[model samples]
Target: MKLLVLMSLVYLLGSTEALKVLVLFPYAVKSLSILGTGAVRHLLNAGHEVTYITVYPLKDPPTKNFRQIDISKNAELFKNDDSLTIGYVLEHQVQRTDPLQIQLVTQESARLTFENENVKKLIEDPNEHFDVVIVDLVETETFAGLAVLYDCPMIWLYSMGAHWQPLRLIDRATNPAYDPDYLSPAKNPLSFLERVDELWTRIKWQYRKTFIIQPEERKIYEDTFGPLLEKRGRTLPDYEEVIFNASLIFGNEHDAVRDRPSTPQNFKFIGGLHVEEPVKPLPKEFQDLIDNSKHGVIYFSMGSFLQSNSLPKPLVAELLRMFGGLKQTVIWKFETDLPDVPKNVHIVHWAPQQSILAHPNVRTFITHGGLLSSIEAVHFGMPIIGVPVFFDQFTNIKKAVENGYALTVPLSHNLPKDLKAAIDVMLKDDTYRKKAKELSSIYHDRLTKPGVKFTHWVEHVVRTRGARHLRSPAWRVPLYQRLYLDLIALVLASVYLFFYIVSRLFKKTPKKTDKKKRN
Candidate 1:
C-alpha cells in the first residue's frame, strides 16, 4: 500500500536509535487501541521495539520490531462494565462525579489485570527487560507497580479528558477555585456560588479518595502485586511513591480546548497523537454514501462504551423520524440493525469514524462528547451537537460550546426533543461551521505532530535515565508545606512568644512601681 511504503521511507531516514518500550494497559476499549497504535507506530518508525499488553489484540502481523501481549479479557470487562447506563446516569447524575467510582473500577481492574496469567508470566521473567514503561493512567495508578518491577523510566500516558485525576501524580492537582471540576457544573472565572460548589465537590472527592478508596486500593495493590515486587527483590512501594515517580506525564489535552493549568515540563499535551498521516482510507460503502450526499453528511457516534441500540425503543423511533426529515444524510453508528430505518439515515454496526470526519462532505457531527471524537470533529472542520454521557464528556461539550463550534443536549427524559432542537440549530447556523474551520486551523498550527512529540518525550525519558530533573518538586512537598501553613503557624507562635516574654520582663523588672506611672 502507499501508506506502508511512505512509512518505510520515514523509518529508513528517521532516527535509527532504538528503545525497548513496554506499554501496559489492561482495561480499556478504543482508548487503548488508539493510544497503543499511536505509540507503536512512531516508536517502530524510529526503529524501536514495543511490547504492548492490552485487552484488544493487534490484527496486523507483528514485524521483528513490533510485538504484543494479548489480555483480551479486559475487552469484555470494558463492554459489560456499564453500571452507568443512561437511565442510571440520569438518576444518580449528581453522584456520577464521585471519585470513588473511578477508584473502585481502577482497583478491581488492576487486580484482575495484574493477576492475569499473561501479565504474571511477564513479571516473573527475570531476563525480561525494558528501557522505559508507558502506562495508561486512567481510573488506576496501581500499575505503577510495573515501574518498580521493570526498574525503568515510567511515563504516565493520560488519555482521559481534562481532569485532576492524572495531574495528582506528577504535580499538585488543579486548584478547585478556577479549575472547574468534571463533576461540578462550572467553568473557570466562576461566580461565588459556583466556587463554593466547586470547593465542596473537590473536598468530598478528596475525602472519599483519601479515607475510603485509598485504603481499599492499597489493600488490593498489596495483595495483587506484593508477590511480584518481592520476586524482583524489591519491597512494595507506597502508592503515592510509585505513582508520583513518573519521569513524564503525557496528557491528551490541547490548551485550545482546555482551561490552561500550570503544568510541569514533564506534563506534555499530545491530544490528537493517534490521528495518522495520509489518514486511513474510508470503506467503499461509506465513501460512496458521503460522496453521493449533495446536502452534505452528518455523523453520529456515542463512542465505544455506549451503544445507540441501548436506547429505549420509543426514543430510537422518535430520533429516526427526526432524521428522516433532515435535508442532509445521516450516518449513525448504531450497534444493532433495525428494519425501519429511514432512507436518509444509514445505520451500521461499526464506522470508520476518523476517515468519515476527514471527508470533504461531512457537514456536522453528533457525538457523546468523548475527547478523541471532539478533537477529530475539530480536526475535520465539522461542528458538533454534543450529547454528553459521563466523565469529561460534559467538559468537552462545554469547551466546544464555549468555542462556538457546538451545542449541548444533556441526556434526559426529553432527549429526543432536545436533541432535535439542537440539531436544527446546528443546520441553520453558518457560524458553527466557520468556528469549526477556525479551530481546525488552530489545532493543526502546532510545530510538530502529536505523535512525534510523544515519541520524542518517550526517548528523552529513556535517554536521561528517567528524566528525574523534569519532575516537579511539588510532588514530594507535603500539603502544609506547599500551602506555607507551617510557616504561618511558626510566625504566629513567634509573635505570641515575643509578647509573652516582653510582658513577663516588664512585670519581673518591678514595673509595678514605675510601670504604674508608665501605664
Candidate 2:
C-alpha cells in the first residue's frame, strides 16, 4: 500500500511538467490553416499552456488562454518606407546598416519582438517560463531573434507542402524539381528551363533574405536580443541549428512525391497533422440532395481567395456550359446568383467542403489545388481536376498528375478544346479513381494520426531541448561545394591539358621536315 501511494505520487509529479509553448502566426487565422489550428488544438488537448500570437487583433477571440499579438497599432513604422518593396525589402534592410535606418527597422522589428516579450512577461510575471517556441515558418522568420532573446529552443513549423522557397531556405540545398500537382511525382516533370525557373525562385528568396530580410531581422535582434544576450554572455544560434517541424511534408505526400530523392533529417514530412473535427451536420436539404444523387456528384470550388463571383464572365460561361453538359448533378459553391443555372446544377453560396468530400456519392472534385483542398481530396479518396492559379497550386496540381489521380488545365482567357478533352478523359477513365483510393489508403493507414504525431513531436522538442538531433546538417554546405561536379570538371580539364601537351611534344615531325626539304 505504501509503494502504490509512492508510485501514484511520482506519476502526479511527472504529469505536472507539461510543456509551456509559444505559437506565433503572423497572418490572420483562416479556416484552412491546418498547421495553425492543428498545432493549437493538439497542444491544448495535451495540456500544454500555449501563447499563440497573431498580428491581427480579435474582437472576441478564443476562450482558451492564448496571447494574441496585435501589430495593427504600430503601422506607422512603415511610414514613407517606399524603398522597402516586399521583393527588395530583405536586401535593402540588410545593406542599409546605418544606425538610423537600422533604428527604424528595429522599431518595426520590436513590435514582433515585443509580442514575444509579452509572452515572456506572462510567464516570468507569474514565475513561469516556456519549455519551447513552435512557430509557423513565416512567423518564425519575422521575430527570429526573439528565440535567442527568450533563450529557448525553437521549432519552425511549415504549414504547407514542400514549396521550393522554404525548402531551399531551410535546408540551403536544392532538389531535382517538384511537380505542382502536389501528389504526382513522375509525370509532367519539370523541364530543364522549369528547373532553372525553380532555381531562379531560390535566388529571389536568397536576395530577399540577405539584402532585405536578414538586415531587418538583424536590426530586430540587435535591438531586442543583442544586449540581452550580451548580459547573459551568449550569442544567437545559426538558423540551421533551429529544429524545424516539417515532418508533415513527409507524411501527407503521396508516394509519387516522396519516392523521389528527398533529403532526410532536415525536411521532415509530417503532414496530415490535421484531422476531421466533429461539427454539426450539414443542413437537411443538402444531406437529402446527397442521398438522392445516384449519379456521383462533381464538387466545384475556387478556394478561399478567388471568389466565384469575381470570376470573369467568359470563365463562368465556360464553366456553366461544361456543367450543363454533365450528367452528374453538379454542386457549385458559388457566392452569387448565376444568370444561367442548368437544371442539373445546384448552387449553394457556402458548402461544407469536407462534408461534401466525405459523402460516397461525391465522385470528382474540381479545385484550385490549395494545400487544404488537395489534402481533403486525398483524405476522401476523391480524384480531382485541379485548375491551379498561384503560389504552390501549380506545383500541387502537377504533382497530382504525377501521382495519376488528377488532371490540370490552366486558367486563361482562351482555353483550347484540349481543356474539355482533358476533363472528358478524367471523367471516363477509371485509373484516376483507382490511384486516388490507393493514396487514401496510405493516408489513413499511417501508424499515428497527424494531430497526434504533431503534438508528440512538439512535446518531444520541449523534452529534448529543441530536438536538435532532427535538424538537417546540409544547410552548412555552400551550394557550389554541395555540387562537387565543379571539382570533377577541374580534374577532367587538368587530365585533358596534360594529355594534349604530352601528345603535342611526342608527335612525329617527319612530315613537316620532308615538306620543307621538298620546298
Candidate 3:
C-alpha cells in the first residue's frame, strides 16, 4: 500500500503541467508597480508559467519560467496621455473626470484589439493553449473576451485597497456607485442623499459598460479575430460574461482599517504580498548624517508620481522654512533642488524608502498615505503624519487616524501651518507611538506571511479547477434583497394598516348615521 501511494503521488506531480497563465499588466513605470510584480512573483514561485504583457520594462526581472510580451515599444494611441500611464494615474486621479481612467479604458480597449490580432495570427499554427488569464481589475472588461475565446479560466486582481464599488461589481451585486469622499466610514455609513449619489454612479458605470466598453470591444474583435473565426463559422463569446472575471485577489489585509463586513470566499486578502527587499543602496551622505544625528530622524516622501516640485511654491517654501527650524534632521524625497537651503534639511531625488523606514533612529514618517508607504511604516512600528493628496489616500489616512497610529492634515494653499501642527501633535504624543507598535504587531501576527497566503490561493484555484465553489452567492442576490428592503416595507405597511383599522373601530360612527337615515 505504501509503495502504491508513493507511485500515485509521483504520477500526480509529474502529470500536472505548468499552468500556462497569460498575465496582462499593460502599465507604465513598472519599477513602482506593486500588483503586477506581486502577482508575477507568486504565480512563478508556485510553478505556474506566466506570460507578462506590459508597456514598460519589467523593473525586477522574473524567474526562468516567465516570458515577456513587449507592448512597451508600441506607442501609437497612448504615447501622449500621462493619465493613461499607470504610475501617474494612481497618484493624480483625484477628480472623477480626471482623464487618466478614461484614457486607460480607451487605450486598454485598443491594446486588446492588438493583442487579439496577434493571438489569432499565432494560433493558425495550432500549438497555443492557456490554462488561465489573470488581469488587473481596471481593464479586464476590455480584453477579457480573448480569455473566453481561448476557453480559459479568468481571475481578476484588485491592485488597490477594497471598496464597495469594485466589490459589488465583482460579485454581480446591485452596483451603487459611491464617490470617494461620500464613501468614507468616518461619516455615517450612507445617508439618503449619499445613497442617491451611489445609485447615479452605478447607473453611469452600467451605461458605460453596455454602451461604451461593449460595442467598442465587439468592433475590435469583429475586425481582427472576426474574419478568421467567421471562416470557421463561430461567433465570439458574449463580451459581458467574458469581461466579468469572477475571482479576485485584494492587496489589502483584513486587520487593516478597512470596512469589510465579511470575507468573500472568492476574494483573497493578500495585502503585503508585493513587498520587495531593499534594492537601492543608501546614499553615503545620508548614512553619515544618520550616524551623526543623535536626535531622531523624520523621513518625508510623497510617493513617485506627484512631484514635490509641482507643489505650490508658497507651501513648499513654508515647509522648507519649518523643517529648517526643527532640531531633528529631516530627509525630504524631492525630484529637484530647492532655491532656499535649510541646513538641517537634506533633499535627495530618490531615498531608499524601505531602508530609511527600517532605520533604528527613524522616529516618524510624514507621508502622502499611499498604501505601500503606510504599510512599511506600520511594518516598522513608526508613528506617522499623513497629508493625503487624492483618491483612496484620503480614506487611508482617515483610517490610520481613527486607528490611533497617525495624525492627518489636509493639503491646501495654507499647508505649512497645518503640516507643522500635525507634526507637533505626533511628536508630542507618546500614545501614537505605542498604538503604532501595537498595530504593527497585530499586522504581523498572521498564520503565515501574506505572500504565502497569496501563493496558496493561486495554486488552490488552479488545482481545484477554478474553485467555483468558493465564489460568493451574494453577487447573485439583488440589492433590494441584500438590504432587506421588502421585509422592512412589509413590516411598515402592516403596522400602518393595523393602526388605521383600530382607529376606525374606536370611532362612534354607526349609531348617528342610522338615526339620520331614519329621520
For each candidate, the alpha-carbon lDDT, in order, equals 0.80, 0.63, 0.67
lDDT by residue (215-311, candidate 2, tens digit) is 6555554555555566667775554343233321233343325434454454555565555656336688889998888777888887764466655
Instruction: Give the least accurate 10-residue stretch of model 2, judged by summed lDDT.
Output: 90-99
Question: Which structure is stronger by TM-score: 1 or 3?
Answer: 1
Go through the candidates in order and give the clash count of each. Answer: 0, 35, 0
Candidate 1 structure quality by residue, lDDT tens digits, 430-455: 99999999998898899988888888
The candidate scoring highest on lDDT is 1
Estimate the overall C-alpha local distance difference test score of candidate 3.
0.67
Models sorted by TM-score, best on top: 1, 3, 2
Among the numbered candidates, top TM-score falls to 1
Question: Each candidate's TM vs. the true structure?
Answer: 0.90, 0.72, 0.78
Per-residue lDDT of candidate 3, residues 1-519 (tens digit): 999999999999755467888777654433334557777887787788887766654766765888866665444444566543223433464433432355345456455536644443544433666877776655335555546555666776665555554566456443343333222423336578766766666566557656666576666655655555555567766555555455555545446544544446776777666665433455787778887877789998888655677665666788899888888899999889988878889998988787787777877899978777778778778889987766456767777887899998766655778888877887788899999999888887889777778767666677777787887777677779989999999999999999999999897765544445554
